[model samples]
Target chain A: MVDSVIQTKDLTKKYGEFVAVDGLNLEVQAGEVFGLLGPNGAGKTTTILMILGLTEPTAGSVRVLGLDPARQPLSVKSRVGYLPDQVGFYDELTARENLTYIARLNGIPDSQIDRRVDEALARVGLEKVAYKRAGTFSRGMRQRLGLADVLVKQPQLIIMDEPTSGLDPEASHEFLEMILDLKKEGITILLSSHLLYQVQAVCDRVGLFSQGKMVLEGTVENLAQRVLGGAYRVLVDVESVQPEIAQALEKIPGVAHVQVTDTKKYQVEAAHDIRPEAAQAVISAGGRLLGLGVQAQSLDDIYTAYFQGGSI
Target chain B: MTEAMAQKPAMPDERAVAALREREGSPWTGIWSVILKEMADHLSSTRIFILEVLILLAALGTVYVASQNIQQTTAEDQFLYLRLFTTAQQPLPAFVGLLAFFIPLVAIALVFDAINGEFSRRTMSRILAQPIYRDALLMGKFLAALFTLALVCTAIWLLIFGLGILRLGVAPGGEEVGRGLLFLVATIFYGGIWLALGLVFSVVFRQSATAALASIAVWLFFTVFWGMIAGVAAQTLSPIRIGLPDEFLAQANMELALSRFSPNTLYAETMVALLRPEIRSLGILLPTQLEGAILGAPLPLSQSLLLVWPQMTGLVAASILLFALGYVLFQRQEIRA
Candidate 1:
């Protein structure tokens, strides 16, 4: 069993009468890439702020690395690195100077600051423009600089809110690779993103939050299976006619429906794995099978199923 | 067999280990870092450097021209060395007066936006996320601005001293030098009061431009317009009839008391005390039979200082009070950015 790195029990944050985060209980395990998947106004940012001790939680406790963020924020912050959804930087300083300043604030030794700064810049592929003022940097470069600021400290747990919210596809792919690289170094990363495909690609586990509560928490595969129901799709290509193939496949146990598109193509819906028996029946019926594949549910399907139904 | 036997090492519980390694220390480290950065930026800016050099040269040139004019016309060197080194006697009291006014304005301009600009740039939230506390941030900023002002004042002071030695061909007496140092301290305190006032406005106002505008407005009101308005108001509202001695006395006291309220008046009065070392009372003295008899006797320096102690304390206390209020506002403010 993996030990939990971050645990929030009955955590709630209220702004006036509006409950921004309502009794959120979350457990992020050590060395896992956890994604907080949510739509706008889902309180994901608010939750991250509470965990960082930026915003006070109205009720309950948040423990990061077994330290209460509210009571011992310095300890939690010293160990964790955070990249806010909207990146803000000092425009007067160059990228190198900015990273050096952040490194100093993180308590790195003066002798080691330059080396760490160079390493961080290199990690983000920003060494070429490191000496240029950040004000002149493009949005993508600024985002990369913000990532370097986090990476310079070599923080154990990195919390990024909407890490790829505004990135182009190529930048997003590069960022995902960096995140995976960090994960490989045994760093725990918790990121919030609206892009389900991006989350599906990198996250080891995910928590789907909606209406200020965690609606679902599991691995991507588990969430897809649980929320999308047991409907399995099987696509096949036949060598010859399939009008009788559909009728014969429909008669198989646990097979719900069968539809033939062309003389060689057919889609079968089943409650279980009936592919073997269906293939055998199709062959016996003189329909030679050309190809066979199982269709798994996508993240979009799981997202739509949970949100549209208002429950997981 | 090799694949079956291969195993990963135990992951060192990062969060737990980091918690164990946490140390206790002052939270002001990050704030000092910001203050250092602000000072370095201001000091390194080309615009500020040019302004400083221009102001310094202008002041020295004015003093030099005034001394030369006095020597050419009057053939008396009494006001020569004094005017060169100090603002004791000059054709342009307004120039010296503007020096007192503009130095504070410039210092305040350098720091008024120190905190608010960070917020406007949205960097305050990022910095505040570090281990530093709010008080540390404010105090660090105050110190940085104070240090910068001190540097400017010191530079100007040394330049004047150098000019005096070169032009006069004699070093100043200990008393004269002592008075000059006191003037420098008073100038710093005066400038600091404005710096604190500017920071207070910065905290109270959301926009940096608004804070700066408010500071300049207050400076203009006190330095340029307030005294004129007070004089006019006194003339219009005077209940004392023109002919009576008692009326004159009452009006004189009222004017003297009211003058102390403005920082400009307070500073001027303090400079007068330091320069003259006589005129024990700021209030006007009634003409008497003994007035003509004791005109030659100068008051002792100790008595002179004691006479002005209340006014000096009031001005310094006002500065301190403004600074304390600024500190309190900064500490209580939420770091929203």
Candidate 2:
């Protein structure tokens, strides 16, 4: 039986009448990247805070590494590193110093700290600017340093809240790669973010959250399929527009619509792979097919559908 | 990532063993870590450097003028070594007066931003997320700031003593040295009250600038204005009848007790009682009460401590009260940016 690194049973958090996280039950295995997808005020951060034992749950229980986070937060915190949203460091301190401070907080002995600090900084690609004050670093670099802060402890579990929220595209890519590397090293990761593509890139499983409720949870592939037979899209290049083809494509069973992109292109969405039939339909409709290819349903589509209070 | 997730979990009882190990480690997980980090930050910061230098120069300048003027022997020829604290030149106040005025400034500066600045800079949540309990972080900040204040005050005291020895050529008697050390401890405790007050403001106010202003405003009220206000309040609360010593006595004692509510007045009283041991009483005494008192006779160090014991305890109680307020508020605070 594989024990989950983090298990929350009907976790709920309420501030006065406002429920921040409502009856959230979640489990993450010992070594996987789990993304929590949510919009602002979706209680993602509140749930994360409860898991880290930073805040107490109004109801239910949390077990991190099989230890009750509320009763034994030190044990849980010592092993489960957290990277808060918009994570910050001691701006006046150098990256090395900041890491050193966190390493000490983890009770890493002074003799081992220097080596660990160097390793963490290097791992985050901050070795070149290790001595620079964190205040001088760009927002992207600071986010990288937040990663280093989490890694410096050599934790068994790492939780990052919107870890790449402020990073540029290239930096976000590197950050996601770092998350993958940490997962490869057997660190359980739970990251919460609204950036669908970034979360899809690295997260093994994801939970869609809305207004403090876990609306859906599954592997991205599983969700894509389960939501709407994983709605497949077809990009069709035609020699000319068929005035009737768009309506005919829509008339096909399970096809939502066929959008015309010029006189020569049409995009189709269907509940299943319909590219071949789409091409045949185009031919029968007297349109010369230049190209046709099937596309998978993206996380964005499922996410949008979920937020719209409907299934894809 | 999928392959890693597919890997088997750890041995069934590994978590139990880890829990046992965590329980066995020392509970004081991060006191030294917080203290060292904060201490380095305090000592290296330019703001602290400027405050220390400012107080040092102002104190040195005043002590220098006083030492230059108070050279003649008095009829009593008593507490010559003690004159370092009490003697004032034509323009400059005594060392104690300068300290009574300046130490709060230094202390308030050190602590007004201690907690809120961490929140504003977004380090509070990260630091508290460590294995250490909330108690350690709050304690570490208090101790570090207290340690810094002690260091600054001790340096100033030593410099003044050194200057006294060089200029007056009179080595302090052992008793006088003991009294001076007690005065130094008292001064730090006094600074501690302001430090705790500043920390309380920091905890209550999210903005560092607001905390700083609130702390300084409170200190100013107590240091410069509270005594007068307390006097007026006491008079309004306890009106006196003409030619009735008991009524006047009631009014005077009321005023004195009300003023002692301010740490500045308590500290000034303690400094005066300890540094000027020849002073025998703090309260307004009836003529009959002064009959047994030998004029200008220096009290023993033990007697001096006895006289100011309540003041010392008051300073300590105020510090602990302020710190408790700050600590409770800090613990209740949600560590979010």
Candidate 3:
């Protein structure tokens, strides 16, 4: 059983009458990449801020590494790194200088600061441009510098808000690779993003948030199964298949529907495995079966299923 | 196994280890980081550097012109460079008096948007996110600005002193140097009051432009126009009058009192008290002998400081009070930019 590194009990945040986060309950296991998936204005950033103790919640409690964030924010913050959506830095300083300054702020020993800054810059693939002032850096380079800033402290948990929101495909890929490398070092991460593919690629588990509430939470596989109702698709090819072949496949156990696509192919859907029976039926019906395959569910399908025509 | 377990000591938990690491780190390191970073940015900004240099040149030029004009008119050459060394023996107050009136404006210009400009750049949230407390952040910025102001002002004061020694062909007396040192402290406090006021306005106003405008407005009202209006109002408001000229003098005193409401005025008045040993009031006093008979033969340096103590304390305290207010506001603001 994995232990919880970050846990919140009924965490809420309100801006006057508007509830930004309401009764948010979350448990992220140690060493796991947890994704907070939500649309715009869904309170993901607010939730992350509260967990980092940067913002006071309206009510409820938050614990990181089993310590109350509100009562011991420095303790929690010391072990957790955060990147706001909009990264702000001193434009007059070079990337290396920025990282070195942040390292000093994090209280790294003066003797070790240079090594840590170099290591962080290397990890973010920014060592080549480390001496360039951040004001002259591109958007992608700035994002990398931000990642380096967080990495310099080597926190136990890293929380990122829309880390790849503005990056192009190549930049996003590079950023994801960096995150994956961090994961290999046994650092737990809490990432909030609207990109489903990125979350599906990286997150060990994800929570779907909507309008200040966690509507669903589970592993990617589990969410896909739960939202898509455990449905499986089987595609078969046949030679000289009859309309009766389609009816025969449906009559078999567990199969839901069979649609004939062409003279020698049919699309089969079932709530469970009906491949064995469907194969037997096709052969017994004097149709020569050529191929059979199951269709894997995609995160896009699950995302649409949860968000379509549903209220949080 | 059970006996071995009982004999072995318990190790610290992960949470305890993390807490130890945090406690081992000094929080003030973050405050120093912010100060260093802000000072670096301020020094590198071309606009502020150019402004500082221009203001310094203007101050030097004004003192030079005033000295030369004094010498040309007096025909004795006694007043040449005398305005720079001391206000003594000169019919008019020294150029330092003009500096006292003008330096606060330059200082205020430098710092009026110090805090609000950071907010405009959206850098406050990032800086605040570090481990530093809000009070440390505000205090660090204030101190850094004050340090910069002091450095610039000191350089200008030295330049003026050097020019005076060159022109007069005589070294200044120890008392003159003592008075000059006292003037420097008074000038810093004067600039400090304006700096603090600017920071308070910076905190109160969200926009840098608004903060700058508000600071300039306060500067003008106190330095240039508020005393005139207050004089007129005091004349109309007062029920009794001694005589025409005396009433005007009374009105002027009332205006001076009212102008003290501005830190700029308080600074100028305090500096006058410290720099000019002969100056008795904002108004001209009777010749020193008659004045000495009324008070004493000669007032001690300590007594003169005591006379201006309220004004000095008021300016210093107001600066501190404004800073405290800014600190509280900064602490209460959400770190979200």
Native contacts retained per candidate? 0.38, 0.68, 0.37
Best by lDDT: 2
Candidate 1 stretches with Cα past 4 Å from truth are A230-295, B1-24, B69-82, B85-95, B228-261, B275-279, B283-320, B323-328, B331-336
Clashes of each: 0, 0, 0
Q: Compared with the true structure, what per-residue lDDT tens digits does model 2 show for residues A1-312? A: 256888988999999999999999898988889999988999998999899888989988888898887668888888888888887788899999999999998899889999999998899899999999999999999998988898888899998988988789999999888888888888899999999988988999999988788888999878876665546778888787878777667777778767887556788877788876787787778878788878777899888777674744
Task: Give the local distance difference test score of model 3.
Answer: 0.76
Q: What TM value does model 1 have?
A: 0.82
lDDT per residue as tens, model 2, B1-337: 8776655455535764675466444546689888888888888989899999888987788777766665566233556666767888767777788888888888888888888888888887788778988878888888889999999999988998898778777777898899889999999999999899988898899998999999888988887799899889988888885858788888889999999999988998899999888878888977898898898888999999999999999999999999998989988988766
Pairs of colliding residues, candidate 1: none
From the highest TM-score down, the ranking of the candidates is 2, 3, 1
* All candidates: CA RMSD (Å): 7.7, 5.4, 6.1
TM-score of chain A of 2: 0.92
Question: For model 2, which pairs clash?
Answer: none
Better of 1 and 2 by TM-score: 2
For each candidate, give its TM-score against the true structure: 0.82, 0.93, 0.84
Residue B310 deviation, candidate 1, in Å? 4.5
Q: In candidate 3, residue B226 scores what lDDT?
A: 79
Q: DockQ for the candidate 1 complex? A: 0.29
Residues B143-235, candidate 3, lDDT per residue (tens digit)? Answer: 877777777778877888787666555666555566667667777877887888888888888887888888888877777887777767676
| Highest TM-score scorer | 2
Please give the distance, in angstroms, between residue B101's alpha carbon in candidate 1 and its true position after superposition: 2.5
- Standalone chain B TM-score for every prediction: 0.80, 0.90, 0.76
Backbone clash pairs in model 3 (N, Cα, C under 3 Å; residues 3+ apart or in different chains), count: 0
